[model samples]
Target: MLILGQSPTDAPVGTFGLVNLLAFLCIVPLTVLFAPVGASLAAKLDANRLKKVFAVVLLITGVRMLAQLLL
Candidate 1:
């Protein structure tokens, strides 16, 4: 939607601003380096344990967001 000028907000569509581009460039190297390590770790982990950990993380994040919204 952002690229097609269909976003609800007023930001200009179809253009990458300098700040956005720079932030993406900075993240690219970190992602490239860490993704392979994360993949290897995940591959060695037990699937059921990973699922439980992921569920707990999601639950904690959801509760935090809900608390922030309520407060």
Candidate 2:
């Protein structure tokens, strides 16, 4: 991630960390805003197929979160 003009990994503690944390926090509203776009794409495709794809996506997300916690 870029902050001001510096890379995140090169930034000092609390600087990039807070920025990343806040960015993650914005996912809620961002998802809401993009929901329509996603729905449109899903419609253009097949709704049933998209639902299955999203189910797998959610499953992978859950597994990744679980692996993170376990690790």
Candidate 3:
């Protein structure tokens, strides 16, 4: 919405690209900080239970998308 809403205002191309670049830059430090924490959490979760949790999440998201498209 920011991009589309601002596009009509004559915001410069470089401004849009800079925002994109800054957002992308945020990922590097975040991954460096969270990767070890995520790995430790994953190690504590049982594989089969984790798989079932992911399956349920996917199923719910899929159903929600289908509902949105249909209704």
Provide the overall lDDT of each model, using Cα atoms, as 2-decimal numbers.
0.74, 0.76, 0.74
lDDT of 3 at 29: 89
The digit string of per-residue lDDT tens for model 2 on 1-71 reads 34444545665445553355455568779999999998798878787888889999999999999999999
| Stretch of 10 with least lDDT, candidate 1 | 11-20
Task: Point to the candidate with the largest TM-score.
Answer: 1
In terms of lDDT, model 2 sits at 0.76
What are the per-residue Cα lDDT tens digits for candidate 1 across 10-68?
54443353234456678899999999998987898899988987899999999999999
Query: By TM-score, how accurate is candidate 2?
Result: 0.50
Q: Which clashing pairs does model 2 show? A: none
Order the numbered candidates by TM-score, best leading: 1, 2, 3
Better of 2 and 3 by lDDT: 2
On lDDT, the stronger of 1 and 2 is 2
The TM-score between candidate 3 and the true structure equals 0.48
Q: What is the lDDT of candidate 1?
A: 0.74
Clashing pairs in 3: none
TM-score of each: 0.58, 0.50, 0.48
Model 3 lDDT tens row, 1-71 = 55444443564444462245466568888999999987887788999988887799899999999999999
Candidate 3 achieves a global lDDT of 0.74
* Residue ranges of candidate 3 with Cα displaced over 4 Å: 1-19, 56-71
